[model samples]
Target: MFLFEKAVTGSRKYWIWIVCLFAVIGAGFLAYLRQLQEGLGITGLSRDVTWGLYISQFTFLVGVAASAVMVVLPYYLHDFKAFAKVTILGEFLAISAVTMCALFIFVDMGQPTRVLNVLLHPTPNSMMFWDMLSLGGYLMLNAVIALTTLHAEQKGIAPPRWLKPIILLSIPWAISIHTVTAFLYAGLPGRSFWLTAIMAPRFLASAFASGPALLILLCMAIGRLTKSSGLREPVQKLAVIVTYAMILNVFFVLMELFTAFYSQIPEHMEHFHYLFAGLDGRTALVPWMWTSAILAVASLALLIPPGTRKNPKVLAAACGMVFLSLWIDKGLGLIVGGFVPSPLGAVTEYAPTLPEAAIALAIWAIGILMITVFYKIALAVRESLA
Candidate 1:
């Protein structure tokens, strides 16, 4: 019943997937070695664009990790039966996502060995320290709750009564993780794009949408692969949650636009102009930004109609569209767009180098591998009970 032993006993297809992930991870490791030897010059980061793809990904994955609470709240606090079957899966997904967030931060630090300085020389005034604390604490909370719950289930015993309090604590902790992350950008003095009062709410709304959409897809895939029957109702319920969250996310985006353009402040307007239409002939991100907007609208159209949202195939596609749209909006667009015309009023463009991309791929591969192993163990336990 050991987790690793159970994980190694997965079917042929699972092992094949693991092998492919390892291959990508290996290549990335080699690329990281080169980066360590040569320093951060291997990345697309420049004096103007200091935070590149790594920070962007870290920001995105933090939202993904915090999304676990949507399921946890209804299942544990409200005692909702619809979320019963997949609560463990959500927690395990959070674990993998938080792991990715931590790894992305580690790799972004050119001197990986000096990461201890964040802890050793604690800066109480810095938001980065608070971010580290929130993510690390959330990771521990999820891991402990998930493993204990699974272990109790395998033994046909209820989880300890005392654990309920800790579960409740995680609800606010989940909100705090992304809120603190937004504060990291929002509090910056010169970053006009992220200085909005709504940044934290926007982050939470988008996280709720993207995180649950991903969970729905994963649930569907697991049910198909495992030949299970109970996921249909849960997946349908999740789709509704995703729809509402996506609506709020889109609303937040529009609110941001209205405030920026209506106010007509050159500092605030420039960031929006640069992201959507390009500034001074720097049109690199305009295409991607528009594509994200179009996809968001299309996905909303599909999600709003109860009939289409209830159809499994349609739901899946809409979930995918929403996920991709948010990834482009928050993942690629948000981080890079904030620095479009830099703080000093100079236009500079940044694109990830091959090695940087490889490293990012490796981190993602590692996260997927972790999820696979965790789910394998959970599935084996469930099958044994059945």
Candidate 2:
């Protein structure tokens, strides 16, 4: 009832955007049901492309979720004045992004409805179950932290002393969410590419890079769209964060390459080959891979220049390019590349079916819609306070 009341009476734009979000989610649900009824056959997922768009989104959003820590760390721990105004907004964004991360996993599962089965009958040995637990716990923690802080602010009173520990606890919990998600990939047995020891580090590096970049982009968007000053100094600080993270991300990727080639393990070498060299005659992914590489280079190149970094438009474009590049690399390229030259030493490829693509689009729409509505409400509340 509270959520409903907030939804309808919130704002015309908010309600309209939510309607669009629901429409898309409904379409995705219909598609999901069709897949459920027909089995995984309806989706582009086969043994080969077992981890498709949905999993890709899950990976990407973990980075998005972790990015909130960037804001929280500076604002709360370091006592940065620049982020004071926007730290709560960052937390809310994390909440919504993490929610979508969970939903994406649900939609991707063969039996999404049976997700509760893990809770009903705990599987201590399963990485998946651990993932579920960690994600759920992190989500609750973030929601509690964000809401309580907001409630305190709204009442024009200090947040309860107890909430400090809870908010502090969420910092580790945030990192754990992304780490566990990376474990989901790295723990798999035969996927040599994903099984690397560096996988988790790479995951964190990319998460830090892309996640902060997205937040910076979102902050800039908010400033332009709503005429809000909205943490420009902190955003610049975050850009510095992304610059270092990108360097590390590139370093890790190169490290992955070094290990694969130097070890001369055919099993490991083959996967990297597919990513960079296009296994067999399949060159479709090659261009995308290069695009990611070049863009990463360009992003770091542009961001390091002082004059260019300070310009909002230039900085925004660089962030956007890095974000899109990482999206392609993590979402499409990594998942698809891992499965090539299947575990059995055979070649297979996967292309998404119409239903699968539609479902993917719908999930993304829902995330955007959530962001839009939440921001709208938050802006109104901030305005009232002002």
Candidate 3:
């Protein structure tokens, strides 16, 4: 209830932001209602490329939710006090990201009831089942851990002893969510583009990078918006984490490309070709893939140099590049790329219809709204303690 107090009371600018989010949400809701009435036919989905923007966002956000561990592990396990200021930010991010992930799944399903069916009929062997279980469990874990830790802060006392175990469990639980999502892709025998053993590792590496990068940007924003102090050290430390993870993610991508072209398998090489150079006459993804490629390289340049990365402005730009680069590659291109040059070897390109884009935008705005309210509550608690 007090949390709601903090969230509900804010400056004029904050109210403006919330109102803007509401506008987007309202428009998106209208689009979704039409979708529910008309079925998926209103979207760009076809028999050839069934999953589009929604599933890609679902996949990318699973990684973002998992990346919270980058902050949690060091702070709790290693006693890295520099992260003390921003650890809650990471946890709140996981909560919001997971919420968005679930919403993306719901929208992608076309019918809300389909989600219940997954629960109503349990299939232990199914990756989708495990994915759902992992996501739901992670969401609860973060929500509890965040609220408990914040309450403990408010009282100027340590979190209860029992929370120790839950905190520890959440670290690995975070990793599991992304791995399971990767398995959802890698497990499909029909999607050759996602069949590689490296998918899980790639997902984890990118999660570590992109997730923390977003955290850095958000902490930067929160510091400005709330007039908070001591965020710089943690943000810089996170930059180093992003640096390493970005390297690994790019390496994993290169390895896939190497295997594809080196093996001279048309099925494999064709997917890469379709992504980078366009296969036959279809080139919808070509420009976006190239943009991701450029951003990946450009971000590496900014982050690898200590002077450039240590500078606050450059670091923000670099983090922005890191987030957007992976968002394009993994969030947008990855899923769409897999389905293209369909199992039958036809070059089919998929694009999101306007309503599809609107609905996706609404989902993103909803996530942003969650983050805004969550952070407002958190900042209020901190200010009160101060």
Q: Please report how far candidate 3 places residue 331 from its true position, in Å.
A: 1.0
- Residue-wise C-alpha lDDT for candidate 3, range 34-72, written one tens digit per residue: 999889899999999999999999999999999999999
Q: In angstroms, give how far residue 365 of model 1 lies from its true place.
A: 0.4
Determine which window of 10 residues in candidate 1 has minimal summed lDDT.
1-10
Of candidates 3 and 2, the better by lDDT: 3
Better of 1 and 2 by lDDT: 1
- Model 1 TM-score, all chains together: 0.99
lDDT, candidate 3, equals 0.93
* lDDT tens per residue, model 1, 176-237: 99999999999988999999999999999999999999999999899888966699988988
Across 141-202, the per-residue lDDT of candidate 2 in tens digits comes to 88888777777776778889998888888888878888888888898888898897787778
**For residue 310, what is the lDDT in candidate 2?**
90
lDDT of all predictions: 0.93, 0.82, 0.93
Candidate 3 clash figure, as a count: 0
Candidate 2 pairs with clashing backbones: none
Candidate 2, superposed: residue stretches over 4 Å from native: 1-19
| Model 2 lDDT-worst window of ten | 1-10
